[model samples]
Target: MDSLSARSSPPPAATSPFSNPKPVELLKKVIFAWVQETGLPASICVRVHGKSFDLHRSPLISRSGYFKKALRASNAVELHQEFPGGPEAFEMAALFAYGSRLPLDPFNVAALRCAAELLEMTEDHGSGNLCEAADLYLNQVVLQSWDDTLIVLQTCHTLLPMAEELLIVSRCVESLAFMACMEILDPEQKRGRPVLPLRTFSDRPWDPEAVKELAGHDLWIKDLIALPFNFFARIIRSLRRQGMKEKYVSPVVVFYANKWVLSKKTHKFWEQEDGADHAANTNDKVSAILQAIVELLPIRSQDPDRNAEIVPVTFYFALLSMALSLNLSDGIRVNLQHCVACLLHLARVDDFLLPENRVLEDVSFSRELKTMEEIVTIRVAFKSAENAEVVAKLWDLYLCRVAGDPKLGTDRFMQLIHTVPVADRETHDHLYKAINAYLSAHPRLCNEDKARLCSSISCQKLSQEACIQAVLDELMPLRLIIQALFVQQLHTQRALKDCSESFRYMQCGVFSGSIPSSTCQLPKSQSPYDPEETTPVPLEDHLVQRSEHSEVEYESTRFRMQALEQELASLKHSLRRRNPFGQVSDCIGSLRWSSQRKYTNRMLKVFRRMSMLGKSKSKIKQRASASGSLACRSKSLNEMYDC
Candidate 1:
């Protein structure tokens, strides 16, 4: 044969039924046409939905008819002979889609969901396309279905291609989409739901009614509800997984039953027992979140991006829900937000804040921090593929609440701060710039409009402790309080520590700024003496004779301390003992209530005293060190390297 002819001649073809001899026939027989003709499964979903909607007209076998049509049309049965998870899935999906919707027939939903899941493991060389179509249908109706929210969440025995797809898509969600859908869920719309500022995520100047109409849609309340679903799912899942259903279920159930106590609709019922009601609300909120994390997302090595973006999204919603449902403060909000930041870091696939992004280490703190530079350069509009505030919030919350516990007090105060690769100079510098700008402008977070102010600033976690301590530098007053409440609230039922590193909000309550004197609630109702600012107790030298005879001389102040400690010990004992009422008041009282106001004050006093002592010691040390020659300073500077 001629070389050209030999080259043109096709190589020995593989043994197959349709090795086309004609080019024209090959085009017609190609898989493209088959795919085009089969089309997407979206139509199948709409058709099934329509048929199912006609209650009296639709037959039980309508789904089978559609499945049969799909099978015949696509030759899916033949395809499944070589594909994966195909034919049986086609049948089960139809049933699940319809079953999940009809509230009266959950068994059908259960049957369909499980049956379809069996096809997942069939491994019958099912067509990826067919399986994908089936998965997409199920995920849209089932995973995101509000009607069968609990069922879909609790019965997470299998992972379909669609759920994986959803997870993938969720990793790239935009803030606009989150805000668009989330704002619609007014916790106030339903009693016991969270009542947060759904409109704006920013503390600067967000309008509570920015997208009021949009927030009121059914699309906003998804099956894996960001708030409602998460809270319940967290509680149920964790308890069930831990096999502690009976142990903690009753108290939580009672708290839930007293939902009436939470509803502002029945505010009068709790008016006299606000503290008790608040405590109950707080504990229930915790239980709800525990149920969600433990139950909703099964224990799987989730995609880093998905975990980074989606985990924190769910958590922020949980935090928001806890804040609204139970009214938390800035201290709690800081802690929760901090915890979120830690989880996000754990979930990140890449150092989102990279060396290129790190302006500080790149050049040292040359009049600017590195991380801040990146922030300034990074565009953070409502939309951006590169944007990840949900992730950032998670990290920020971590730094604030769990990272550095100053009370470990010494070297550890900077542990978390250092453990987290300090934000590069750019980011740090950028933060400084923002801070300076804010301070220069005398920036105010609250608005004159009552609802606007309430919506914009969450006072729940923005207590003096959170701010002055500088734990939550990114958090504002309102956001901080809400964050803190979630921590305090969630901890009562289930510790955030039990959650995986990717989900736990560890340093969530770290506050920024100084803990002002007014941070404590002054007892307006029972102040027997004026609040003391400075100075120590006066020694009555002239009363030496009286002290020699009167054992009751130190009565009042000593009595106050004993009374406070007794009250606190009793409260802790109650919490340890599990109060008969089952409220978490005991936990609250232990954390906040003390008889010796002076004793608590003294702890603050000790901090101040230590501050003075350290300053004096440092001054003396500095003077003594100065005794070194100026030439030594030059050598030390050379070793340090120039900034």
Candidate 2:
């Protein structure tokens, strides 16, 4: 009865029966067979790299929009299409289009992805597009074993616009970036590790080849820079958005951002002479870069300290570096100044937290000094006397932080302090206190260090006092000396103003080279203190009025004129020597010119170089001393042997 019931159930649905066929499945099989050249006659001929491929037109048109459009516009039996990739890539795409099992491995996945994207194909079995399938395979399977990540990145970069259009490059970039920061697990660690290990920039995957390859692409990185501001911001922002476990997003962002900035700076386009067009273009680029940086800045204000630490130090520094390099307009510059200042502050904090990062040590120091120089320049340009106090505070903060580093010692701290020009009393006092506080905090600082630092303070005080006193002393002495000299000159002028015509004529005749004789007739003045002064009469009246004593009077008047002239010359010389205020003002003007921000920065750089040279010399001297000691020991041993 059971057998009868089973037989009555439509013969168990006739498993694997061919009577009612699946036409679509059968068609796929026929297409795969056609690709292998084992089924229906090929209707369309496709040539890739001079190799003719026999393929079906219906399947190619159905699977690939690129092919559909190409064949629709052509009437030829054979179609010629260009594929930039290898022949193997096209072969994989052709087989993939026919519903054949596409063999995806590390060796061919990237190439297949490129080809699939180029051909605009979709998978036969899955709902996913072929480009997406290749992307998944490349990232999940192939990238794990693939060693040449840079080469793959280069390939993707070459086809950036197309790859981006296909929505496949993102995964490729993410995978590569993940690998760049992936921690290398030990054998034991690997055994207990999760399926996907998490990492950050702290893991520090240092691959020299990767760095070299990235540097090689620096010239072509303009593709990244040319991306619209939103796209560029999205690229950086998305790195951190991937999951909480991934802290490495910032490192790769910084690395690429730095490269992008450097590339744009050195690009041939910006090297052109500035004009209306160039300025407009430059402004556009500056705007784009500024917007991108603003987007990358930390948004959280809950914890100020952690906010900066959230992003790697290099990211902030890269932004700051780019900011300094850009020719931002005054309006933009003013708005972004705070942003730059915050970055510099954050960078210093990072350096403090991670002092062992020798890679960033010199860069941090150079950047810090450059930032100070820029701030000072801007302040000076504004010429706001009130800002001087702010500038002094800033310098104090910088100096305190620098002195806090045990390696720098008190000497370098004092050296930096000496570079500051004389400031107002209040500013100087604040700076002094800041320095003292910094020194007091140093547990290892010795008495000699304290004494030396104290000496720097005392020297500053004494120098400032001396400058003030010099200005005051010169001013007072100059005024007094000029007043005394003017009084003596006033008496002489009164005597001259009171002289009558005959006396003046006798004096003039003797002084004038045209006169043959020194003697002449003269008349005495009524009073030396006369309120009204009169000009001398002509020589005839004088000659006739006092002929008897004319010779004596002429000699006396001539002597008086000579004495007055001598006194007048002395007065002029004295006045010049006594005008100390003018001299001091000129000196102050010269000092301002000499102590400009640019000059001060140059001097600081020169001082740094000299300090480096001095250290090198000291090292050489120590080496020499050690070698001498060894030589002396050898000599003693030889002497002992001889004895």
Candidate 3:
């Protein structure tokens, strides 16, 4: 136990004058030389003093058998609040050994454990001024015992939830400063001489049952906010060294980052009880983090592949930027905004280097995208009770009535529209378009999506059926716009008497409850073209609704058209075959006569039925019409006709 007593031999491999060896070897040498009969070296004594000093503060005996057992894999427990430091120190040594990628030398094995202990003390334990402490021992730390590092890392695993809080607070700078030391000074988790800060949040799909799972592993908020800067530094250094020259490697990295980015995109910064605390991140702190992300963004961006197979891969840097700087303090929101703006810029960098991809490109995504997007989604709306009220505000900017007028003010929509730069228009359009395209081209957002985007609905009773009722909610605005346009265009035409046949058709189609020809311009083509768009197209298909996932739109439109055409053809055939005269007049006359008396009777029956429908439409109308003149009669006549 004496500082001057040498107990163990230095393990196998020696540092070659040639290639770089591991840090654990050095650690072993330190331990072998330090526990000597003579006086300890200045550096060796200093390093041991720090790791051992905590022993005095903590009650655990340094030489306890329990502590020794923790050094081995036979027992590992870092998740609990009370993991022993001696065992924890052993875990660190093991991790450092693996990471340093050197042969295990028993003499420096203690050094590796010392490194792990240093990192845990700073990152998880608030052990000391982690950077200064780790830096003091960095010269003596081992780098070979990385597997051992995992053992140590496994002990610090519960840091995930704490990382979540740090992310939310937008204390990303502090988070980076916190982890930066861990990455470098620790010599275990740290690799490649990374000087910049780095925080990693990894949650694999599976975990030991009844133990811990990554599925629900919420990251420390600080880590989340610091993710942008930390991830960027980590990725740039780690990936650049790993050879981004590998064709798909960059893409994969991009994919993971994109998931985190989009997930943060949807997070409502204001949702937390302490949400306001993070408001500070809105300022310069966020800006600095954003600047870091921008500095690391990749240069050439393109997915030349047809499928856009790993499309999200392109978003890695952006995702990291997003994940970081997430914990925006009230002061940091500006910084977060600036960071977001930079991310948006990064996402849109290439603008256009190739023909736009229009097909429903499909790729199997890891949960990263879903996870980040969920964060983005949740943040966008439900971050606070206040956010819930403002969510429908999207209608103010995006929803349009009849492809022309937005129900929300035009100025408002235009304001929002202007916010999207021309360079990003295509990507933003492609994203939503691609989603709808995927859904429409493949399946609806779900199986019930069939019920969502059919583009055509069969009019059953045309009454208030749930589906029908929903349709009216959507189409009534459309109808209002159509009616407005009809009225506007009519001024240029003539009166009802002088209007052309086309005018009558338009009017009748609308009033008679027949689906109107798509105001979106119907195409003359009878057959589906393989080059057909996935989204609904106008007359010539110049990317009409490509912004809505061209694939899905195309599929929906194609299906609806096919169905409608078949029905129209059958009706025509029946008319022609039955009449022999190639006339609809005979059929029309018979139908008219059969319906005249019955239609009038049905009108009365409907009025009686409405009494049970919980409405007083008739009474209201009657009350108003009681004093009317020609208008009243005409109104009554129209109602009768509808019956």
Candidate 4:
């Protein structure tokens, strides 16, 4: 009975050896206190950047794989391991290994992450992964400032191996891309400028004052140009995908792409085995890089207006440089060469001032060609050899022989004329001779057209007025009336410059249906005591009382002003509506032609001509003629008006 009672008592609650174990926080405190305050014996020594840290061997080996292998490999009193991140980074890493919270601040985070990667300190022991902790600090702290993040990313690119190990490069790119996307979708951001506003990562609304402060510092585009090629490519591609326009992005892309190509081509003399091999290697590399970059770049829109807008003059020069140097694939080379020619064409259209333009500052570009023939050759190549012959014929008939209407090729022609410096005697002589040869080949061209074309092509010794006169004299069977009209219009234009204010007033009167009486008259209150001074009269209420002679003079002036305006309007209309021929076509038709399409099959050809003429004459006002056949009369007054 006593044994059963004793068994039921559970052997007096046997003492548990594991009872009252130290709390984790208290235990860590005690260990740290012992390490910091007490003279505790440390079994290992870690040397970093010539500095030694005396640490416990057990903790070092348990927490770091590096220490474990390093210590096991040697039984010496101290274990010295190589850490690349210097002493400070090693100290931060060591603290992390000691079960202490990491000092993952912005200033030290990048260094610490690099050290962790170098030391293989990536284990998770409830404290956290040091690499991840550093990254979090990077994102939350360092990346809060755009400049800081950009600098870090650029640094990471330079330190390729360390960055890849820590994953800083990719994460930095991601952060920039996200910010770019935010800017793209932000409604308040300006349409063409992707200026990102400053804000915290907490997703707070951007402050107006902060934006104002940032305006002085809004130059991310310039910084973007300085990024490593691959990183720059990714950021630009990502930005474009979010909604940036191709025109805005294409110039920079081309610039950097050309720059990158040039950079890669910079080979050491010893690196190349032979010219052929070097060329082949360069060609292959260029093709690969261009293809990859092209895939990531923004595609130009189908809108011709947007495409036609002028890029920086440097774009053409850069592209031309690429064409002359890099042995790109046939498709890419042809396309790029065509772009170079097209840009030259566009530059001419924009009246690109070569002397003033920055692109001409490049010595390589300026020295590439010394002859006008070279410029013409580039243009001809742009049209392709097969098309060049026919294209020349088309231009001669429409642009030269007719009345000097500027066709699409006009800009390219003008660009060719001005690309050479006036001081370059040899080149200018070559250019002058080339122009004369061109003019002499096309004899049927009108005097005015010849005069205009020669005027556009600058000569070294010949004054512009003298050149025009020489070309005009050389033209065959000049129309005296047309020449007289051209001179008269020139004189009228000179006179109109002086009468600009009056012309403007007259224009306003025409639109308003009444001229303001005050426009031409002095106030009656000049004496400061006139009877009309107290009466505040509205402009519409005012009536003038003057002598008959003064009235007659005023009437004559008004009539003269009206006639001058009419003549100017007619001159402007003529200049604006001329076809490539500089002459209006013979068959002017109306909407009546479309309604009368059901006319007999005999008149189908006539109807088609009428339809074609209707489309051409859409903007011109139709006038009835009293004499001659339809074709003859159309050629007479209409051709005169069209030019």
Q: Which is the leading candidate under TM-score? A: 4
User: Model 1 residue 565 lDDT?
Assistant: 36
Q: Once superposed on the true structure, which residue ranges of model 1 sit more than 4 Å away at CA? A: 1-216, 219-282, 285-294, 297-301, 307-413, 422-643
Candidate 4, which segments miss by more than 4 Å at Cα? 1-38, 48-54, 75-84, 99-101, 124-126, 142-148, 190-217, 251-305, 308-310, 322-335, 349-643
Report the lDDT tens digits of candidate 4 across residue range 309-370.
52333334443445445544556544544444443433321221122233434321332332
Model 4, total clashes: 0
lDDT of 3: 0.30
Off by over 4 Å in 2: 1-43, 47-88, 95-136, 143-154, 160-162, 173-235, 243-294, 297-326, 329-332, 342-390, 393-425, 428-643
What does candidate 3's lDDT look like per residue over 1-643, in tens digits?
Answer: 1111121321233222113244335545544444363353222111221243111111121222233344345222243333223333343343332222234332333333333343343333333322234333322332223222212222222333333332311222233233333333344433342121111111111111211222122122112222334443553454345333323223333333333333333233423423665544343443454445434444233322311222222333333334343533333333333332222212322210111121332112222222333323433432333322222222112222111221222233233333322222222222222222333334212323323332222222122232222222222222221222222222212221222233334434434556344632334553224356675433233322222243343344234324433443343344234343444422122334444344324323332332222242222221121122322332443343221
lDDT of 2 by residue, 518-600 (tens): 44322255222233647645554444343335445534444443453454344334333423345532111123443333333
- Clash pairs, model 2 backbone: 501-536, 501-537
For candidate 1, what is the TM-score? 0.21
lDDT per model vs. reference: 0.31, 0.44, 0.30, 0.45
lDDT score for candidate 4 against the true structure? 0.45
Question: What's the distance in Å from true for residue 627, model 4?
Answer: 14
- Deviation in angstroms for 257 in model 2? 4.3
Global fold similarity of model 2 (TM-score): 0.38
- lDDT tens readout by residue for model 1, 1-643: 1121113322232222112334223322332343365653222222221222111112122333334444445432222232212322323343333332222121123333333333342223233322344344444554343333333333332323443344422311222123323333334344232222221232222122332332333332221232333234344344444443232222232222223222333344444456757657545645444333332332232343443332332333333334433445544444434433334434332222322233333323221223322222232321333334443343343333321221222223233233323222213322222222332233332222212222322223333343222222322232232233332222211211122121111112112222233532224542323347354322233123323333243233234324433443443343344444654321122232353233234333432332333233322221121112222432343233221
Which model, 1 or 3, shows the larger TM-score? 3
Give the Cα-based TM-score of candidate 3 against the true structure.
0.25
TM-score-superior candidate, 3 or 4: 4
Distance from true position, residue 271, model 2, in Å? 9.3
